[model samples]
Target: MTDVTLMDFHADWCGPCKTQDPIIEEIEEDYDEVTFEYVDVDEEPDIANEYQVRSIPTIIVKNEEGVVERFVGVTQRDTIEDALSQAGN
Candidate 1:
């Protein structure tokens, strides 16, 4: 099986990031096969820069092959779930 990871990039001060957090949390509960990582841009600038994340609430779904999908801003739960399903497959 492939190793799938969901990276959430955001800062504590970002409002949109707050909005996106719960959706990610829900996805975390549903997708046990996917690894979830939360990166605080303020604390982990290098990681954010490595991912080229220019905005808050950036959701990146990637597998061992590499990044499969990237969503900027507030993303819908279904959209993220779909991306995970595809990437996992």
Candidate 2:
């Protein structure tokens, strides 16, 4: 299994999520060491509920040890990279 995983929770109809998707995709392309995954809230409500996601564009970064960081809404690239660095990605 990958050491670090970035979970992006979003829905197709969400405007903010649409904006966030490309940013996440860009991060995925830039970070080969970090695993990136997308969860469509509309299709996977269970996963959203498990993560306690109350809004769209929720991002969860975790490693094998456990969760490193989590944020909601639009996030800065440097901030995400910092979390990945801390998580040993």
Candidate 3:
């Protein structure tokens, strides 16, 4: 099975992203199998552009092979878990 990696695409200026930060932290503590990475759009413009992340809070879940299975805004716990399960498979 491939390992799961969750990339959070966010800008420091985004209010909604700030709110989601705590929730992500909680997920990190709760799920040991999921790896979480935060990417600042201002610092990592290339990554943001590559993912076409126009929104403030975008979540991208990838397998070890680097294939994205989930891409959307403001990820919830269940959504992230589902992605992790798929990646685990």
User: Each model's TM-score, in the order given?
Assistant: 0.96, 0.92, 0.84
Question: Model 2, which residues run further than 4 Å from truth?
Answer: none
Q: Which ten residues in a row have the lowest lDDT in candidate 2?
A: 1-10
Sort all candidates by TM-score, best to worst: 1, 2, 3
Q: Per-residue lDDT of 5-73 in model 2, one digit per residue for the tens?
A: 999999888999888887888899998988888899899999999989989899999998888899999
Q: Per-model C-alpha lDDT, please?
A: 0.93, 0.88, 0.81
What TM-score would candidate 2 get against the native? 0.92
Which candidate gets the maximum TM-score versus the true structure?
Answer: 1
Clashing pairs in 2: none
Q: Which of the predicted structures, 1 or 3, would earn the higher TM-score when compared with the native? A: 1
Model 1 misplacement above 4 A: none
lDDT of 1: 0.93
lDDT (Cα) of model 3? 0.81
lDDT of 2 at 43: 97
Question: In angstroms, what RMSD does candidate 2 have relative to the true structure?
Answer: 1.8
- Per-residue lDDT value at 59 in model 2: 93
Structure candidate 3, residue pairs in collision: none
Please provide, for model 3 over 1-89, each residue's C-alpha lDDT reduced to its tens digit, 9 standing for 90 to 100. Answer: 66888888888898888877887888889878778889999999999899888887888888867756655666677777787788778
